[model samples]
Target: MTCHICNTPSNESFQVKVLFKYDVTYYRCHECGFIQTESPYWLPEAYASAITSLDIGLVSRNVRWAPTVEAMIRKWFQPEGPFLDYGGGYGLFVRMMRDRGFPFIRQDQYCENLFAKHFDVTDQPAGKTYELVTAFEVFEHLADPVATVGEMLRAGKSILFTTKVLPNPNVTPETWWYFIPETGQHVALYSLESLHRLANRFGLQLYSDQHDLHLMTAKPINPTWFRWFTHPRKVALYNYLHSYPAKSLLDHDFQAVSDSVRKQPLKDLI
Candidate 1:
């Protein structure tokens, strides 16, 4: 198999089991240190079922952290215009933003909300551009993250994304449940360095805050106060940071994402 991100051959890479039902296997690239499933096929029906079983409340929690995200968004892309929520599931975040008065569009494979639009990152409309685009918990599922992100950059002026970052190099398939290769969904694993490398490759500046969530904002330049945030050791850092005095930022971030969603024209898919 070939490494999806760097296109290097995966002949000597170590294999890790990800999921049980689907029998997914991921290969860790020796050259780029990227972990991904080998020749994985997308089983939409199975994936959809898995997603449906997840708690809706957990998905809605993005609203609680919106303020901090918004502050970062404003610092990066001050003038928020048309925005797109790539892979926005069930329009919960979109609905939250609409309620808060931000005009934005929601696109996902499964969502059918009136406020939602359907779009695939690999097959986006030509000439469509946005002031901001957000994709939370979406990158790890990709087979070719480099190509996927390149398409996102082509479709937007700025991007706000969140995903779990692997910090420990020693935690192998036996120690981490996330590294299991059985489920082909989470093919790519990233660290802060890998994420930054991706941003640099696409000419985007990245700012990441570790809280109960991994909030990452990427644009053409680094946002103000970005240098002050501590690097995340794990996803748990997000929860720890939010418990401190900085918790107020979460509300603001939620408002910003919500406000951006309300301004979008519901009729336009692009």
Candidate 2:
């Protein structure tokens, strides 16, 4: 098997009995440290429900990460510009970001845009570039990781994505909860080494907390703040400072403020 991300030949690493039904084969590529399951024949059944039952924390996860994403944008990316939530499930993150004042657009072919219907990218003008694109918790679900990341790069110069890296060699696949076979949605998994290969292949700089949150950008980020955020204590402090009552600058405005209030010269009629 060839690694989907790096196109390196991979050897069969292990196999798992998915949902106690399908016996799945997993292959690992030493060149990129990428692991992938064989062609997902069970995908239709797996994705019948856009949000799987195993993903119960979907809403809360978006809520919790909203502040973190905001902080990253304030520190690294420009405050204003288009933002897209790729593979944005239910448009929750897009709505949350929009609510927090960022002009976020939602794009998810499989799932319904339940929250941010007004901000669909499909309705927007074509060839519109975004400042940043977020693909939180979506990378692992990709069958073609490289193609998806390439598309994201085209959509924006920077991406803030979330995916839990595979644990060390000491941990066996049977012990890892991330490879939930019942859902059969998580086909590709990447390690830090694999991500670095991706960054190098695409000529992008890679930054991460070495776990879940990661960023790939063509522009240089403030290393000082980036390094600071790598620490859990510092991140917690940042989160606390930005939480409720300290309104985010990107908070969404439901109405068109420009149209609601009359222009000064025209207001005499009212």
Candidate 3:
């Protein structure tokens, strides 16, 4: 098998019995440190429920990440342009971002846009570009990483996505919890090396949490805002404070509150 990210030859590392039926062979590319399952014939069965049972943390994950995403938009993008949530299953994240007062749209070919049906990209005219695109938990499902990223970049200049990077070089397919063959959905697993290869391939600056969240952008990112929002408590607090109801006459008072919060020293986050 050839590596999905790099064209180098890959060796079969191990096999897992998926759904107590198919023996799925996993391959690893020494050149790129990318691991992939061979020809996922059971993908349809895996995707039967777009939000799988294993993904019970879906709503919580969105809630945790929405504030961070909002901060990212505030730091990097203008407030007016469209924001896209690609591979947005059920449009939950889109709804979360919209609730934060960020203009967000959902785009998912597989899942139903149950929550944000009106915000679907299908409503937009063809050739519409976006200020930014968020594709949370979408990278691991890619069969062709480069091509899929190319498709994303064609839509926008930057992409913020999440997929836990394989942290240890010694960890095998047998030991990694992320390689859940029962779902048969997570096909491609990447290491930091693989991510760097992708960054270099696409000429994008890669920013990562050394864990699940990652960003690839044409321009530099703001480190101060990045530090402020990446913290779970800070994100939660941002979401909480923003949720306060404000009257029209007290809009300036609310703006003062928001500015004071935003300008708080980064040291307080520690």
Best by lDDT: 3
Compose the digit string of candidate 2's lDDT tens values, residues 21-120: 8999999888778889999888887878988878988987887678677778766677676799999988889878877777789998889888876678
Top candidate when judged by TM-score against the true structure: 2
lDDT of 2 at 60: 77
Residue 101, candidate 2: C-alpha displacement in angstroms: 1.0
TM-scores, all candidates, are 0.68, 0.85, 0.85
Return whichever of 1 and 2 wins on TM-score.
Answer: 2
Residue-pair clashes per prediction, in order, are 40, 7, 0
- lDDT of all the models against the reference? 0.57, 0.80, 0.82
Please give the range of 10 consecutive residues that has the lowest summed lDDT in model 1: 114-123
Among all windows of ten consecutive residues in candidate 2, which has the lowest summed lDDT? 245-254
Per-residue lDDT tens digits of candidate 3, residues 1-270? 998887899999888888668898989889878999899888888888888888888998898888788767766776555888999999888877766676678999889998777678998888778899899989999988899999888888899999999978656756788887778888999998899789788988888887888888977876565667789788667646654441222344346446766887989646
- lDDT, candidate 1, 241-263, per-residue tens: 44332223235556664776678
Model 1 misplaced stretches (Cα beyond 4 Å): 9-19, 50-57, 114-126, 180-183, 210-224, 227-270
Candidate 2 accuracy as TM-score: 0.85
- Quality of model 1 by C-alpha lDDT: 0.57
